[model samples]
Target: MPISSHLSQSPEGDTFVKIRFLAACTALAAATALTGCSQLAGSADGPQKVTLWLMKGSASEDFITKFTSSFEQEHPDIDLEIKIQEWTGIGEKVNAVLAGKSKESADVIEVGNTQVAQYIETGGLSEVTLEGLRVWGSKDWLKGLSDPGSINGAQYGVPWYAANRVVIYNKDLFDDAGVKPGPKTRQEWISATQKLDKGSQQGIYLAGQNWYVLAGFIWDEGGELAVETGGQWVGTLGDDKGLAGMEFYKQLQALGDGPKDADEETPPQAQVFARGQVAQIIGTPSQAAEIEAANPALKGKLGFFPIPGKTAEKPGAVFTGGSDLIIPDKTPHRARAVEVITALISEKWQTELARTMSYVPNKTTLAHLVEGNDGAATMAVGAAQGRATPPTGRWAELEGKNPIKPYMTAVLTGQDPKQAAKTASDTISKVLSSDR
Candidate 1:
């Protein structure tokens, strides 16, 4: 998706937002909706409550408190009720609420950017294009965040923040091997890795079943895991382009000591990378803290760069992993919900959030805000080419019983790439094409 120039709210838009907030408060006061609202707001005459569901660890308690205090001060008529949710079985929990099975539903919910398709398929999200595009400059939103939220030209989720994989390398290891820190192209990367893959040092620790990393290589080779055709989705991992990506992965995996049968989580890659022998790992910048915590000895010795692409002109594509804000269709506080989203995505808050969390702001224009932070800046470079997973509600199911991992292990273990890819693609097709 081509990024259009960012559009900002005009003076008139400021008035419109204020009017919308007041109108929502008026409606809430007249309805006196839920008894729960009274308790949450602290009194019957308290501010109109707008409940929000935020995932645990999305923001720090300090950050949340600061934002909540500021937001409440700015909009005195609204009381923001935030509920922290966990990632474990979040899909089923979200489904229950969207299906109206839960006793209480959140007016606004933060969901994984890629997970928006599943919720959209449930027909439980309110359309937010008017606010997203017109009020906020969503036209300039990162495609990785915006693309998944939009399907068939309708928008249901507001892009909040994004994070993409970058090459986290050991500076000490690179110096020992006489290799440069940044390799602009894949061949250069491989050459450097070969030099660093000497005795007692793994050039890179890339788990065989890290399909998210594979997705980026596949995209770099101009292949998609799945694509929509005539209204039905089809898996394409068996295509020639995909096979080429797998070929690269195999070549790269040869330089690592990572296990062929296990995913990165089996013995967490961060822990593995922290042992100080591995030169690089493709991971989010946030994983650095974990790596440091495991071995505090390597605190300032780590370096980062965008993952190398086929060519030096741009960084390799990456799978964007982050959250988006969506309003449930059942929420009576749609107007207030949109208002809160607006406040969060505003340039002021976006910059603050990005700096505080070391996150990539939703807009490409805001990339400069994190340019001073090494990890975040490197991630922002990759975020330009970031892509989300196959935008299908069933994509999650495909992930649940992912055949790609086993297929990767099969190929890495010496099976023919074509045959392995074919088997995985067939499974992907069957899962994505299912109606259940």
Candidate 2:
């Protein structure tokens, strides 16, 4: 998806991604009709087609249409077929297709950063290396996105666009509460939250069960989601450092209001805040688009800032959540597929992609594209301080299949942070070591 765009929460707290993803059978049928993708049976005598699977709206429709046309013009002998996949169960769909190494899978696929490690581990994706990344602006690639594209020593994915969480506050509410737009330090942040909680308005809203949010808290505390040493993955959250981070997260929970009952799929942060019930939300820049679309009155009332660190000069470290493109290991025209990937991340495409979609470009040098824009600017600084969840290939399973969110929710609801960390850590250790 487009920097957690697939994870968009609707006004009523529904997972909008669920609505976009079709049943596997139906999606395959539609994709077949649209792209006439092959089952990886054999090479064609004439123009070879490179199948690309992506979410329905990962990029602007206009961008995709124009880019595809221009790409075909340059590479006349090759046909680029885009097969749209749903965010829901895309991992599994890719999993099934890549299992036997047939030509049926997409030549280039847009995989979520969290899922990249697992795909690379399974030998499903071709190893997209750091040297290969040079063709796609390697020197300027965002570390948070590119790092997640690798597992062990080989890169299997290339950084696409990215998104980092930033503070989106209601300017009117903040001014009325006697607080300012961007609180530079932690103390100021807490005070602002408390003040906002006084009137009819609630304070900051942090989704208690969102693991991505949890990972950011860990990074801020100088802890990590996991660590690898001596060829083994170990869960570190059970340690003193990790426990301290979890406890800090608990303190933030006390200052915020959110739909904790919604499990890992927290209420749409933008929608809930748009109703004028919440004062601040640590949210994606794209949320601004949804907010304005639903309630036009909020356009100017909303203001954004990168969450500050302990001091004023630094932005808080955040989990770099976004999309990545990888070539399936079995792609026949690997060289041609790479050319398409290169074009997608080119300076021209990335600039327009970031501008139209409000995403952080894959390249650090492109920050100027969002220079004066508050929401985009906030995300730009955030990407600078961003980090990946973990490099473990089983990270996807650890996050989705494990009890990490339940553990965080428990701590938020009153369980001791240390105990919660210990429990979640044990599960993480098990998941990360399972494949080994």
Candidate 3:
């Protein structure tokens, strides 16, 4: 008998309805079976499975595979199902899943450091407290990297890896400009930039849209981007400290030392620097990997230092942004997931991941693990010593609407410094108010 004909002659004439009924029955039976099995399952695991959702593509694939294989070897009864997700529009996807609209798609998720706080605020992540820290062995795991992901004293994520900005300069360009090799004070930074600005090549190349780069300067000057006062967000970009920082950026723009508006893309900064079109750039140490991939010939010619500031005593700050591992609140296997996370952060795994990814390890001991390689160890040490900017939940939104970059664009394109600073401060105040 044909299936459709059989269904039509049966109690349900509609084939669609019959199929739906069958599916419903199957689902119910499966749920009951799983419920019964759940009662029988315990820590003396015969078989345990964990599903991890990671950002899509090759970046996470190799790491996940290697890590999972090692873990499964250690615990033969455990199995890992790795799910790769596209990062594009991930926030909306996470929101939908958290709203109970989608089935629980992930047991463990990788979140960016900047987004971790917001995820915790919305209850999207499980709370990993000081008690949870005990499970991970010690409380001493990269507290600097982990603490930023905490809210109101409860940690939401563990540091997977971190990256921070540094000053990368073309040594050939510097030598050609007759600039001495050494650290530069804030005044000397300005002077060197002016001197390096010969006709053929500019002295510096600042990314017009990079707030991370801008924040470093602001932090060095002790400027507060936003302050929580009386349970409300208040603007501080117009204050003296902020104004001083803005002035420094504006001066760089005025000197024709930064990139043009069209060159705002990160690759072009590396490209221009490699081609000797720009003398210096403020970029993350990970750019070493980027430069190698893009322009291998320019590798040995690069000189890196912690970014300079107005005073030698205070090095310019770098925005500490990196990836974090978090267990979702709805995870089915919390204890196992936590164990996996701890294993990943262990000294052995951290050293391996750091060496492979050129990322800063959360463990302090892993800082020296990448030594003798091409400047990666040195860069890690520089980042460890540099001051990190305060992270805010609304950083992404505020950065998008801020006029600091636009004002920077104007200044680089020949607007007056004072006018640019004033315009930037006004726009910053508006952005700050909107966040409240």
Per-prediction TM-score, please?
0.89, 0.84, 0.79
Model 2, TM vs. native: 0.84
For model 2, the stretches where C-alpha displacement exceeds 4 angstroms are 1-46, 96-105, 130-133, 259-266
Across 225-314, the per-residue lDDT of candidate 2 in tens digits comes to: 778867777788877767766776667767766655454235667778778777887778777777778789887788888877767778
Tens-digit lDDT track for model 1 on 287-395? Answer: 8888999999999999999989999999999988888998888777666676678788888888888889888999899899998899999989999998988788988
Any idea what lDDT model 1 has?
0.80
Order by lDDT, highest first: 1, 2, 3
Give lDDT: candidate 1, residue 313: 92
Which one wins on lDDT? 1
Q: Write the per-residue lDDT of candidate 3 for residues 28-93, one digit (tens) a residue.
A: 332223223342233453465676655543133456566756765565545556666655576766
**Model 1 — which ten-residue stretch has the worst lDDT?**
1-10
Worst 10 residues of 2 by lDDT: 14-23
Error of 1 at 86 (Å): 1.4
Best by TM-score: 1
- Could you tell me which residue pairs clash in candidate 2? 39-104, 40-103, 128-155
